[model samples]
Structures are given as C-alpha cells and as structure tokens.
Target: MNAAPADQIRLLDVQALDVRLSQLAHKRKSLPEHAEIDSLTKDLLQLRDLLVAAQTQESDTAREQTKAEQDVDQVRQRAVRDQQRLDSGAVSSPKDLENLQREIVSLAKRQGDLEDIVLDVMERRESLQERVGELTERVTSVQAKADIATARRDSATQELDDEAAAATKEREAVSAVIPADLLKLYEKLRVQQGGVGAARLFQRRCEGCQLELNITEVNAVRAAPRDTVMRCENCRRILVRTPESGL
Candidate 1:
C-alpha cells in the first residue's frame, strides 16, 4: 500500500517503539526471578512433603520409645517386689526359699533385657527427631527464598510493564498521524515478519533482513515516486528509503 515518504519514516518510528515495547514484555516474562521463583516454589512443596513424612515417622518412633520405657518400668517393678520379698524373709521353707532366689535371678535378667530394648528405641527416636528438626529448618529457609524471589519477580514485572505502557502511549501518538490503511497493513505485516513491519534501507542494505538489494531492486526503488510505499524484496517488510539508502 502507498503512503507518503514522510509517513513511511513515521511508520518506522512507530515500529521501533513497538519493538522496544515487545522486548520489554519479553524481558518481563523471561526474568531470572521468575524462573527462580518457580523453581524454589516447587522445591518448597517437595520439602514440605518430606517434612510431613519425617514428622510422622518421628511421632511413630516416639510412641515406640514410650511403650518400650513402660515395658522396662513394669519389669523393674516386678523385680523390686521380688527383692523385697527375699529381704523380708517371707518364704519360710527351704524349697520355697530356693525357688524365690531363682525367681529373683530370672526377674533381674528380664529387667536387663527390657532396659536394652528401651535404649534401642530411644536412640532411634532421637535420630528421627533430629532429622525432623533439620527438615523443618530447611523448609523455613526455602520458603523465605521463595517469598523473596516472588517479590523480586513482581517488582521487575511492574517496572517492565510501566515502561511498555509509556512506550505504547508514545507509539499511539506516532501512529495517529499515519494513514489508517497503512497502519492496518503494517500491523498485519508486523505479525508476518516476526515483529518487524517497517525497516530503513540503510546504505543499500535492507536492515530488517540484513540483505543488500540487487541492482534491479535498487533501481526500481530509486525510480519509484516518493509518495509510493516500498517493500524489501528479500524479506517482504515495509522498506523506508532515506538519503543514506544508497539507492
């Protein structure tokens, strides 16, 4: 579509601003904090899950320890009662006295075995408790980092969005002067040309495609009317010619 030469240059200005706005938007999406926040969030979830499991195991181990201690206490109490009877001379017959002494020995052995089981349970519970504590601390640290990362990401996105909004306002002002038909075509081509709708033909090269024009293309563009719109033959982008175009 044809537009004034000056309008073509204006179109390039609009395109330039639009491109900058696009870059800023892409930068917002691709911010390092965005990725960091996402990664840390996932880690936080996994850590919490692990912590829950650890807490459950620790609780179970604690219960086991409690039961083991109770068993030891019961055995010790029975042994104490047997010793008291022996000391009190409660059994008068010789056979009965011999049986009481043997029973005391058996009770002592039972007490020792129960105490050993309690010690084993205590050791395991202590280890599980330690692991739970470590996981809890780690979860707190990871969550803090995730929160910080989220804040940073939000701030960066806001900055970029503000810049893009300002640039868009300026772009609208520049676009208002250009013809509607031309803007429509440029918008359509912007999508088609990978975000570049208009480009300057600088020093015999199409800057959009970074390709030099052939002699025939150069002559045709140079000979065209100033009010006529031109396109880069290589990349199908709106070509804005200036004195430096080396036509």
Candidate 2:
C-alpha cells in the first residue's frame, strides 16, 4: 500500500496524539486523589460502625442507671416509713422499740449500698455517652475530607478527559487526509504492536525498534518510491522516512 508523503507525516501526528491519549487515561486512573478518596471512604465506614456500637453502649448503660435509680428511691422510701413508725411512740414495749430501731439501722445501710450502685451506673453511662460523641465527630470529619477528595479527583479527571478529547479531534482531522486503506492497515498494526504502528526512520534507525537497518534492508527502502508505505523488517512497524533517515 502507498500513501502520499504528506499523508505519511499526518500518520505520525495521529500516533503522537494516540500516545498522549493513552497517557491521559493512565493519569486518570493513577491519581493520588483517587487513592485518598478510597481510603477516606473505608475509614468513614469503620468509624460509622464504631459510632453505632458506642451509641448502643450508651443507651444500655443509661437504662441500667435508670433501673438502679429506681431501686434507690424505693429503698429510701422504705427507710422513711420505718423512721416515722419509730418516732410515733406506737410501740410502748422496750423490746419492740429496740427491735424497731435495729430495723431502721439495717434499712439505712441497705439504702446507702443501693445509692452507691446508682452512682456507679451513672458514671458508666456518662463515659459511654462521651465516647459516642467523639466517634460522631470523627465520622463527620472523615466525611468532609472524603467530599473534598472526591471533588478534587473529579476535577482532575475532567481536565484529563477534555485534553484527551481535543487530541482525539486533532487525530480525526489528520486521519481525514490519509487514504482509507493506509489507515486501516495502521489501525490493524496498532492493535498488534502496543499502539505504535508507525515510526520515523531517523538516524539510520527504525525508531519503533530503535535498531539500525541491515545494508540490504536500507538499500531496498532507499530505492522505494517516496509514496510507498514501507514496513521495517526489524519491528514490522510502518517506517516513515524523513530527511534524517540516513538513506
């Protein structure tokens, strides 16, 4: 197949844009902002889970404190009634009075023990509530950071996409001037050659393979017409010769 000399040059332009497009795509995937967003997202999920556990602990502890407080109130009310009975002088017998006083003392001790238990429950509830609050704040902070990272990542991706789009338009413009057969062959070769189907023959070297041509290969290429679309024997890449080809 043969294409005009100028058309072969346009193929090089298309190749350059294709290489840039590949680089842009790679950049989009490998952005550090993307990694940061992923890490923040995971951390946010774990923090939210911890917050749920903490809230449950706080709620359970509060319920325990409520029950303990009710027990304290009930014991105190019993002690009050016993004291009132003792002061009313309703038990005139010494033995009965002495027994009544002893009962009051026992009730007081029991009330003190119940109050202590209530205090302990209250303390535990307070501590758990505090932990829940802390975790909630951490979750909020992580969510904010994740939002910022997402915005930055999205902005970066858009910029790369726009640039790649422009390069693609430029590639299409160059493709329009080249022969359909030549373009098809280049596309087919690109699929098999890691996206590089054509390369310049510069400084006596096939730029695709970066290898110097043998004498026989060099002579054959030199004798070919300027419009002939040629392939490098070393790399099988289409070779577009320029003034520096060292023919």
Candidate 3:
C-alpha cells in the first residue's frame, strides 16, 4: 500500500483522535458515581425489605390488639349481668348467690388479663410503627442520594458523548481525503494492532511498538521512496516517516 507523505502525516492526526476517544470512553465507564450508585442501590433494597417486614408486623399486632380488646369487653359484659342477678335476689339459694359472686370475680380477673394482653400488643405495634417510619425516612434519604449520583453520572456521560461526537466528525473529515486503498489498509492494521494502525518513525524508533529500528532497517527505510507506505518489522504496523525520523 502507498500514500503520499502528507497523507501519512494526516493519518497520525486520525490516530490521535482515536486515542482521545478511547480515553474518553474509559473515563465515562470509570466515573466514581457508578460505584456510588451501585452501593446506594444495595442499601435501598435492604431498607425496603426491612420496611416491609415492619409494616407487616405492625398490621398483625393491630389485629391481635383488637382481638384482645374484644375479649376484655365480652368478659366485662358477663360480669355486669352476674352482678345484676345477685342484686335482684334472682338466685334465691345462699349457695347459688355465693357461686354467682364467685363467677363475677372470675370474669373480672379474665377481663383484666385480656386488657393486659391488649396493652402488650399495643406496645409492640407502636414499636413496629416507629421502626417502619424510620426505615421509610432512610429509604427516602438514600433514594435522594442515588438520584443525585445518577444525575451526575448522566451529566458526565453526556459531556463525554458530545466530545466523542465532535472527534468522530473531525475523524470523518480527516479520513475522507486519504486514498481509499491506503485508508482501507490502515483500518485493517488498526483492527489487528490494538487501535494503533500507523506510527511515526522518530529518531530511528517506531512509535507504535516503541522499538528502535536497527541499522539495516534504518538503511532500508532511508532508501525507500517518499510515497511508499512501510510497515514496522517489530509490530507489523504502518510505519510513517517524518523529517525527525533520524534515517
């Protein structure tokens, strides 16, 4: 493959733009906000799970408290009816009256026990309610942080994308004037050589492979025609010659 000396130099410009674009892509992927958002997302998931559990417990405790209160009310009602019967002399027999009084006392005791259970259930529900509230607040706070991180990541990505778009436009314009055969060769070598298709031979060294050309290689390059495109022996990349190539 052959290209004019000037065209080879412009290839270096294309290479520079490609390198810049690669760096920008790496920067976008490595943005700090990516890791931060990941961590925050984990926290949000755990907090949501805890909140759900607390809410469920609170609901269950509410039902338990209601059931206990109902038991207490039923026992108190029974005790009231027994006392009225005793006061009206409806039992008549002394033994029946004594038994009625004893039944009233037992009902009162049962009601008291049920009330205590209701109190215990109410306390647990209150604690669960407080826990749910705290977890919700934490979730909101973490979500806000994640939102900010996402915004930052998006803004950074947009800036890099804009810069890459500009570079791409410039590359298109620069690559347009080069001979199709030469550009095609460069593109092939670029794919084969890890993005560096062409390199300058500066001070007897191939910039692509960072290796100094030997005396034989230097002599051959010196004798080659100016319009000839050369490949580096070390790395098989297009070796572009410039005035500084210390032939």
Candidate 4:
C-alpha cells in the first residue's frame, strides 16, 4: 500500500496527543492533594487510637472511684456497728470495755484513711474525665479534617479520571488518522525511549528533550525525504518538521 503524505502529519498529531496524555497522567499521580490525603488518613488513625486509650483510662478511673466509694461505705457501716456496741454496754468486763474503746479508735482511724483515699480517687477520676473530654474533642477535630481530605482526594481522582477518559478519546481519534506502519513504529519507539517516541523539530531543536540538533544531524534530517520518518540524533525522538523548521 502506498503511504499517504498526510500519514506523517497525522502521526505527529498522534504523538502530540500521547505526550499530552502522559503529562496529564503524571500530574494526576503526583498531585500534592493525594499525599496530603494519605497523611491525613494516617493522622486520623492515630487520633482514633488516642481516643480509644483515653476512653479506656476514663473507664478504669470510673471503676476505681466506684470501688473507693464502696470501701468508704463499708468503713462507715463498721463504725455504726461499733457505736451500737458501745451504747449497749455489751462489754461488761473492764478489759473488754477497754478493748472495745481501742477498737472504736482503730475503726475511726481506718475510716479516716479510707475517706482520704476516696477523696484522692475522686480527684483522679475528675482529671481522667477531663482528659477523656479533651481527647474526644481532638478526635472530633481530626475526623473532620480527615473527611475534608478524603473529599478532596476523591475530587482530584475524579477529575483525573475524567481528563484521562477525554485524552483517551482524543488519542483514539488521532490514532485512526495515522497509518498502521507509522503507528507501529511510534509504539516501538515509545517503548524504547521511555514513553516518548516523537517530537517536533523546531529551529534545529528537538521538542521532546529540548536539545539542539548538531549541524550534521540537522542537515541529514533536512535532506531526508519528507515522507520518511526522521529521528533526532541527540534524543532519538521521531522528529516532525513543520513549515517553520527551516528544513
């Protein structure tokens, strides 16, 4: 099959579209918002752990306070029994009476000690409650931030998908106009050159790598048939000469 002259120009357009698509994909992958979203997700997890720890501490303090209150109640009940015994004169012997008096004193001292402990525990429980409250608030704030970050990430991803879809459609349209052999050559070069196969040669400069072609290479490319595929000597990118290329 005879090669159409327009095939070369159409191949250039196809390469241009491929380059644009590559740039768009790279931009999508390297978005700062994606990194921010990842970081925020990690922070949210840490915040959740902190909230769980605070809640566990609050529960432990609450349980301890309950036990302290129970201890105080037990001591109070024992004291009441001692007071009843003293009032009834249940211990008639002098030794027994003296012993009962000592028992009462000891019970009072124990009650005092238990009350002190209960007070201390109550103070600690209050502090834990405050800490839990603060942690809950912090978790709330972190969760809100995570939500916002996730939303932004989703929005960015959706935009990228839309752009990629559009680029694909455009590429398909351009590919239809290119000859099969030229398309095959472009694909082969794209793989060999790390995804960039073609470039426009403008004023002796290779647009792919932005490198200037040497005088000999430029002359050789200029002398080549217009329908022949030419590559930049420096970058090996397929060079498409335009009217302004001074070829």
Top lDDT model: 3
lDDT of 2: 0.90
Q: What's the number of clashes in each of the models?
A: 0, 0, 0, 0
lDDT of 4 by residue, 71-120 (tens): 88987898788789888988688988888789889888988998898888
What are the TM-scores, per candidate, against the unseen true structure? 0.86, 0.90, 0.94, 0.88
Better of 1 and 4 by lDDT: 1
lDDT of 2 by residue, 1-247 (tens): 8889999988888888889999999999999998899899999999999999989889898889888888888878887887888888788899988888898888889889988998898888889888998999999999999999999999999999999999989998889988899899899888899999999999779988899998999999999999999999988989998998999
- Per-residue lDDT tens digits for candidate 3, residues 1-247, read 6789999999999889989989999999999999999999999999999999999999999999888888888899999999999888778998998899899989988988888898899999999999999999999999999999999999999999999999999999999998888888889988999989999999999999999999999999999999999999999999999999998
Put the candidates in lDDT order, highest first.
3, 2, 1, 4
lDDT (10s digit) by residue, model 1, range 45-95: 999999999899889988888888888788788888888988998878999
Query: Which model is ahead, 1 or 3, in terms of lDDT?
Result: 3
Ranking by TM-score: 3, 2, 4, 1
Those runs of model 1 whose alpha carbons end farther than 4 Å from true positions after fitting are 84-97
Top candidate (TM-score)? 3
Global lDDT of each candidate: 0.90, 0.90, 0.93, 0.81
